[model samples]
Structures are given as C-alpha cells and as structure tokens.
Target: MATLSAGGQQDAACMHIRELTMNACKVAHSAAGAVAEGIATGVNALLETVRPREIELDRLDREIDSAVTTHITGATEESAREMLACMKLSIGMERIGDLLLGFSNRALVAASRCEMEDVRDLTLMASRLEKMLSEVREAFEMRNLDKALAVLRSDAEIDRLRNLVFVRHLENPGGTHRSESFHVVFMTQALERAGDHVKNMAEEVCHLVSGQSVRHLLRSIDKPLEQMFLDQLRTKHAL
Candidate 1:
C-alpha cells in the first residue's frame, strides 16, 4: 500500500509539469502574435497617410500646369512671375509629398494593407512613378542597393519627358496670341523644375541606399541644365 501511494503521487507531479509546459508555450505564442499585430497596425496607418498626400501632390501639379498655361496666355509680368513662383512652390511641395507617400506605401505593404494596380504604359506613367517612388522609399528604409539603382534609372524617363515639354514650349509657344509667351515660359520653367525635384528625390534614394552623400554629384549632373537656364535668363535680361 505504501508503494502504490508513492507511485500515485509521482504520476500527479508529472501531469502537473506537462500542464505547466503547455500553458507557457501558449502564452509565448500569444505574446509573439500581439507584437506582430502591433507592427502591422502601425504600418497600415503610415501608408494611408502617404497615399492621400501623393494624390494631393498630383492634384497640385495639375493645378500648377493650368495656372502656368493661363498666365502665359494673358497675364502681365508681375502676375506671371507670381504665378511662376506659386508653381515652383507646388513642385517643391509635391516632391515632399512624394517622399511621404513612398514611405507610407512601403509600410502599408509590409503591414499587408492591400494590393495596388499594376499597369505599364505611357498612359500609366504617373502611377508607375508613384510605385517607383514607393519602392525607392522602401529601398531606402531597408538599405536596398538594387532598388535605389532601379529608381535612378527609372527617373531618367521622367527627365526626358520634362525636357520634351520644355522644348515643345520653346519651339512652338503653342498659343496663337503673342502676349502668352511669358506664361508659356513660366510653365516651361515649372515643368523643368519638376524634373529637378524628381532628380533630387532619386539622389536622396541613392544616398539612403548606399550610405553615400550624392548632393554634390546631383549638382554636377545638373550643371548643364542650370547653365542653359542661366544663359536664357541672361539673354532675356539683355533684351
């Protein structure tokens, strides 16, 4: 009877130990899950903030374009310069907006916010640009060299289009009316600066990815454009 009582006590102890082990495992799993969920929530909130800002920047760009077109066609010098300054401000503001969107998009994706549309064409360039910007931001955050390089290459096309727009304005001056030249020039300047802002963002991506400062490099790259603009301004002043 004594031996049997001892065996029974041992069995009870073993069962209790197994129960405690199982409970501990469950608690650990729960804690890990909570941490993951918190991270996901934080990422989603960040992305939503980015998306609306990008959209607003796009809207502002359109507004700048319209203002430039209108002012060039009918406005005086003071009015045109004021409008041009506003357009430049819009370009600067939009670049900042793009950076914010890029950060948010990555965070959202990391958090599993939702899938975005994937289309490729000139018609979809704006969307593509937005996606590329987002990827650039992600690369910067993750220190991804490949993605940063990709963004630099992709921005080349944007530069090309911007130059095309500027050249077109200079070559054609579009409107039948003579008074609109000032406004057209202003629009061309805004478009060119928009390209510069995009280039600046790409340079930032490169810096963030490689841990190298590229501000000087960008300034070097832009020298020709800057010189051309300066020459044009000097010629205008001479006249």
Candidate 2:
C-alpha cells in the first residue's frame, strides 16, 4: 500500500472537495432534469424517469455535507457566510429532489383514479418551476445577482398556481373517487414546495453575490401588499 505523504494528502483532500462540489452541482442538474422530464412525460411516466435518480441525489447530498465540513477552512466573515450559503444550497437541492419524488408518487396515485379538475395550471406550474431550477443553478454557478433576482421573481407565479389549484379543489372536489382530487392537490403542494426550495437557493445565491438579504427587493416589488396592510391598520385605528 502506498501511503500518501503530507502534501499528497492535502492534494488528495482538495481533489475530493472538487469532486464533491461537482457532485453537488450534478445533483442540482439531475433534479432539474427530473423535474423537466417529469413535466414532459406527464403523470404516468414521471416515476419511471424521476424515481431512478432519487438515490443518486441523496448520495450526492451526503458527499456535499462531507465536503463542506472538511474543506471550508477559513475564519473570515465572508468565507463563513459563503460556506453557510453553500450548505443551504445543497439542502435546498435535496429538498427539491424530495418534492419531485413526492410529486411523482402522488401523481401515480391520482393516475390510478382520474384526471385533475384542471391540468392547465398544473402544467404551467411545472414548466415555470423547471425554469426556476435551471436559473437557480446558473445564478449560483455564475454568481449573477440579476439572474438570482429573476429566479426569486419567478416563484410568485408558482404561488399563484398553487392557490388556483386549491380554489379549484374547493369548488368541485367531487368525483367517483372524490379522494382523487386531493392527489392533484398533493401534487400541486409538492410543486409549490419545490418552487419554495428553488427560491431558497436563489436567495442564498443573491446573498453570496451581494452580501445582503433579498427582503428589500421583495418589499419594493410588494408595494400593493404593503398598502393593503397599511389600509387595514388605518381602518382599525379609526374604529
């Protein structure tokens, strides 16, 4: 057995970190591909394409955690924040993989029964989320603040689609298998959660690039919501 000398050991460790980081990146790309293929193949073939990747995703996430712990050796504040962001990004990707798996399972159950009340919104949700995942990966890779902001902005439509599905479910959640509607609901919930994780990753990317939170950007875009709260406060004060 050839023993590694001290410098060789350091080089080996650095190479491990690089491989781990690339695997973390591969997890993100694989999840994104799974999501896109799931959407394209519809509900039935989704598991065939996506389920095969879940175990690999989990393995990549474990590698990422090990790499971050072993490689992120720095005392500066920026470095600390960068490591934190990197960890969050890994967790966010893992959560997205979980959500995609959940989506496939619930959709499979739904398929055994009936179609959704309306699938148009669900289709749109999947498409938008696929785009968001790609943008998140790219923004993080490039550290482009604007691209990160766009990824965050795209999450709003996912939220809207989730709300639409819920409203539709409330209106006509009646079928031979009334429980079937809830499967669609569950699927939408998974997609919504996946979008949330994408947003989380995007926020971390924004933080990495700007060294600041994205809350201010949100507040600026949500002026109408702020005004609505202000109006409610004024009405309460008058009462």
- Report lDDT per candidate: 0.44, 0.69
Tens-place lDDT digits, model 2, residues 85-159: 767777777777788888777665554454444456666787888788777777866778878877766787789
Per-candidate Cα RMSD to the true structure, in Å, reads: 24.6, 7.8
Model 1 off-target regions past 4 Å? 1-95, 98-125, 173-195, 214-239
State the displacement of the C-alpha of residue 7, model 1, in Å, after optimal TM-score superposition: 53
- How far residue 155's Cα lies from its native spot in candidate 2, in Å, is 0.4
Error (Å) of candidate 1 at residue 11 is 49
TM-score of every candidate: 0.34, 0.75
Look at candidate 2 and tell me the lDDT of residue 22: 46
What does candidate 1 score on TM? 0.34
lDDT of 1 by residue, 99-206 (tens): 444433443443232212111111123433444445444553455655655555555555565455445445655652333334333423333343355445555556
